[model samples]
Target: MDRKTKIALGGGCHWCTEAVFQSLKGVNKVEQGYVASHGINSNFSEAVIVHFQPEKISLKTLIEVHLLTHKSTSNHSMRIKYRSAIYTFSEVQQKEALSLLDEFKSKSDSNIITQVYPFSAFEPSRNEIQNYYRQNPEKPFCKQFINPKLQLLLQHFSNYVNEDNIKHTDQK
Candidate 1:
């Protein structure tokens, strides 16, 4: 078996990001958390720390999935709290993330605005917010915002999804 690795990602609400990544086949764990931001005031962005097997899925693939599942380009009108970002724990991760961004930039029309920063700290979200979608599937926000992302993953990345993580009845 391959050793697992962890990466912290912030694309949007932690609840949404957590639910999407938790379904991936190689992902052993997805913890919702807050990562220190580059902005003033020492605020934190909602993020997820994902533990996955690199042998089963490459970091590049994970980065692709992340960009696809959330809006990486910033919208000036939207709050900066949920801006897309990759918080790297090492120089290798930072390099890899930049390479992916370059690759993505070359293939797309719009710019990839996802930020890459050295990880400072990760504060796990409260219990009520963990495993949110599974526990509150019927919540309006989950049905409205999260279900579509889940369906997109199911359709485009079926091979990466864990069987047990396929909880959407409509997809089944």
Candidate 2:
């Protein structure tokens, strides 16, 4: 069996981010919660720790999907609550994330503000809200905010997306 790896991501609503990662092929689990790094990012922010098999999904692909799914370029007012960050478990992971961000920055007109920080801690959300999207697919927030991100996954990362996890708009 392949060893599972983890990467913590935060940029938008935890519900939306959780749903997006949950729909991916290699993702074994997504721990929806608040995460905190060191120094300036000491305060917990909305995020999810994605557990996956690297052999099935590359870190670069995961980062790419994450960037595309959220407002990676925006330093919005709620940024304190929803930090744009990639929390890595190792120095290698941090370097790769930084390299990927730099590469993306060169191609896009807007700066990729997503920072790579060392993973420090994670506080899981309440059990009631753990799997928010899957549990409440018909919720207005799921339909309005999350569905679009799922659709984007289907459109651009179809090979990496788990189609079974996608609740089609017609079915909703």
Candidate 3:
């Protein structure tokens, strides 16, 4: 098994995507960063570098998790920079991604606008953003934005949470 471990992603903003994926069961860590954003440079867009155990989570499952996260909060249009996306690192990921779009198109009644960027570059986000929601849970961004998204995460991805650090999203 190839067991690819990381996927670069940017969904509107990192805080929301990070908050959600950071709680997934197989995911080891979700690092905030940027991917191509300049057209072919979609990798330049803000992203979350997800580290996971491929043994536990298939690439398809990761993509599904991403799409689910996107669907949950997409009503507010926070999925672009805050929008949901999965940046592909391989041809398999690419094909699987295209398959996902096709699957979503057939299953849903709404038009979806998301970026599927090929690998390019990833500049780790600033230290302040490393865990913006956790460190400043009382801040406006956390209270207004991150928290609302967290509500979505809790409602949907609760199984991924570790009771000991359920609020790690606010602390890290």
Best of the candidates, lDDT: 2
Cα lDDT for residue 165, model 1? 72
Clashes of each: 0, 0, 27
User: Per-residue lDDT tens digits of candidate 1, residues 24-138?
Assistant: 8889999898887454614687889999899998898888889888887666555357758888888998998888878987898888788778788889988987899889888
Q: How do the candidates rank by lDDT, highest first? A: 2, 1, 3
Q: How big is the positional error of residue 118 in model 3, measured in Å on the Cα after superposition?
A: 0.8
Candidates 1 and 3, the one with greater lDDT: 1
- lDDT for model 3 comes to 0.65
Listed in order, each prediction's TM-score against the native is 0.91, 0.96, 0.77
Which lDDT values do the candidates have, in the order given? 0.82, 0.92, 0.65
lDDT (Cα, tens digit) per residue for candidate 2, span 93-114: 8988899888888989988899
Global CA lDDT computed for model 1: 0.82
Q: On a 0 to 1 TM-score scale, where does candidate 1 land against the true structure?
A: 0.91
Q: Comparing candidate 1 with candidate 3, which one achieves the higher TM-score? A: 1
TM-score of 3: 0.77
